[model samples]
Target chain A: MSLHLQPVRVATSSDDSESQLVFAEGFLVAMLVHLSEQHEDDAGRWFLEAGFGRIPSRDHPTFLDLDEAQTWIRQQLGNAYVS
Target chain B: MASNFTHPLFPLIRKLDSIATLTDEERQAVENLPVRIRALRARHEIVRHGEKASQCCLILEGWACRSKVISEGKRQIFSFHIAGDIPDLQSLHIPLMDHDLCTLTQATVAFIPHEAVRDLTMRFPSIAAVFWRDTLVDAAIFREWMISMGRRTAFDHLAHLFCELYLKQQAVGLAGEHRCPLPITQGDLADATSLSNVHVNRVLKEMRGKGLITLRSNTLVIEAWDELIRAAEFDATYLHLQKRAVP
Candidate 1:
């Protein structure tokens, strides 16, 4: 399944506004927020703000870039499909 | 250790005195109890889950916490302890541990044998009542924590915890003037509140932006105590301190 990302803005009530909506086969799957400078060492990283179906909610992991995020999302979706 | 330190058990006396009055004879009895003092580094485990303990550890200095680790090695901190708190007090009766107790900072702890504690309580019924009362207050605090974890928002939950921590330390003469040593990290806060570290950081920034509080260098300064209390809807009745400390 191909994954697609669309840039968007999330009203996180903090400096982290830049975000992207991730879609798996045109189905919205996750929302990733760009870490703001307020995050200090983690600034500029991508944080999994929220995830739907097959994507874990408890583990809001951060990635160095969108590619890494997609890789993780694909893995989750693959796991869901395989099981 | 103080130069004029009369006994190593003074911390325990001070702690008990915070909630209930201790008679002179009871104080002397506590002072006379056998103790083993040891200094430990941060993150040192004093007691592990499922271990049968023969003694209870009392925090003489620095901080400790009762916590449990679940799947994926994620830890949930149940309580933060300060000087004079016996985080493992239940071990005196329940020899088998249900959770882990560890130091959050460099600490000096005194281990009191269960036999001595049991003997002290049996001989001094009033002290036994005080200990029972202390456990009751502990349960009350747990109830409050349940409310925070289950119902309160992350912001409100954190605010409530800060208020509780400050008040607890103040009652023990370890904090004052709306300021307290919050030596734990944001990760620690996340575990205690059951929130993600990112969420904790966001709330902290929001709090700072609103001029509510300032956390830096392991010290938390309540910039607007009344506003924070109002926001958290904090009521200190659960703490059950006999003589309430200042705000």
Candidate 2:
């Protein structure tokens, strides 16, 4: 479902916030949310909107780095490039 | 009128602008085509993974499903293609298809040859943008589906999908008053949400018991909008139609 326009989307310093997360279109929002909540510092700080009514975090698994994280994210999004 | 497919789905292509660009006499030169129409029974496979795609399949009738399978046979459905959808336009570029498309209801479709579609696009550039943007919107819809299937819960997933299909079909004048044609079965719903059939059935019952939604005879009537939207945690930004209004 997630198709990249560039080879890899480089996250700029400007993009290092919850507000810019709005620009992260489509399934990318879901991917970043996983990375942000699980990876903590590596992912980015979360912006909680009282609107989103989930348990926030349930499985307290150790978070992954960027490269490894993107793989898991892409898998969740159902990439044709991967299995 | 030989051509009447001018709708909001055609991006960057103005309907009135097209009138001056192409004359009715010249437009008439290309045949409107009497195409062969076929019917697909509910839940029947119209196209499967690895099948050679040759025709431009247009969903002229009921709702249909498109999905892909993952490792350990985990299935993830991309999105539903309703009327006016050419579900496989991107398949032309990829050569081999990696997913399956099936009818969720007793559906009817018009098949146009690939070559004819290319010719048709060349002949009608305005309509071409419409189809291309339709494909772009199709990709956007997949992005939303990916979110629901991968992250959202069973009830949330169903609610988000219901909201999405209702809005999309409404745009085309196919849906009305929170009532929409949804022929998807509980099993099919499970496949889309990445949940078990029992889970899907239970979720449906829960929603119905809460009086949030109702499903009977292939039609879904959403009785509570705010409750359903809150359950799904869905926002409509991904569809990207807002770019048209920024001026």
Candidate 3:
């Protein structure tokens, strides 16, 4: 009936990996490049063909490890915020 | 109590064994936390929603799944709990569960009370860090799985899940290169992958058809592991489970 909204950092609940760090800063540009070119077409479908679904292939850009993924995410934030 | 923890996650927890040099009493104190054990059959709810956050259940054996119930009776599974996984570790702060914790197979779990954990962390600050890292890793997994379910195709999710399990089980000394036994069903996977059961079945047949893996019984024999790993794009950095074997 009512809501239990608290102060929790809500990440993206969409089929887009770019949701993880969207609001922080220049990630907007990276995500724009990410969502438009790669995920909008068949490159995204390859993951479905493989059986795993829901990863925004385009946003990731590369199949990097988690550490590297985090690094790239931080860089996106730092570059965007610093500039 | 015997100090040699024969639990499967011992290797994983042992990796956080920076307190090995503690005195005998301290070692015993850390190792002697009251552990409540529970065994569950397939497709059981180990813990349900709306219940107060209580003891953290450390998964000792078998497979389990954590999911959230959405509209239209659909379930979105966050992670599969295998040997050595503390499925309820995230209960540290959340007052009540926002999702359901269920078992997908006959499982063994040890209930470590929150107070005990808090007290233990008080004595050993690194325990908190280790567990904080553990929960952070769990959050990382949720993020990755969410990425797959939100963006990738069905096949990549399956491949990624298999690679994930193989590596996760291996960290706990439960798996090897060629064959890894996972007690999972297609319906369970369908809930996990956010796909229809029929779709999961069709794609599994395709994966087998393409010689990526061989599924017989409940176990999986990865005939071409490198191919499967590549297909899933699996990397082991997330696991962070490299325990120096005992001397």
Worst 10 residues of 3 chain A by lDDT: A44-53
**Which scores better on TM-score, 1 or 2?**
1
> Taking the tens digit of each residue's C-alpha lDDT, what string does model 3 give over B1-247?
2435764445335434531233455456656788777777877887788888778887777787888887657778878887666788778677488788888888887788888878887887656666687777787787888878887778888888888888776665677876888788777888888875545665677688789888888898888889987888877676666542221
lDDT per residue (tens digit) for residues B182-207 in model 2 = 87776677777766544455567678
Better of 2 and 3 by TM-score: 3
Clashing pairs in 2: B10-B130
lDDT of 1: 0.89
Question: A1-83, model 2: which lDDT tens digit per residue?
Answer: 43332222323222322321211233223223222322234344222111111212221122243344334444444433331
Report how far off residue A45 is in candidate 1 (Å): 1.7
The Cα error of candidate 3 at residue B238, in Å, is 3.1
Docking class for candidate 2: incorrect
lDDT of residue B187 for candidate 1? 91
Rank list by TM-score: 1, 3, 2
Winning candidate number (lDDT): 1
lDDT of 3 at A67: 39
lDDT of 1 by residue, B20-89 (tens): 6767787888888899999999999999999999998989999999999999899999999998888888
Models, CA RMSD each: 3.1, 15.1, 14.6
Off by over 4 Å in 2: A1-83, B1-31, B69-74, B240-247
The prediction achieving the highest DockQ against the true structure is 1
Error of 3 at B70 (Å): 2.4
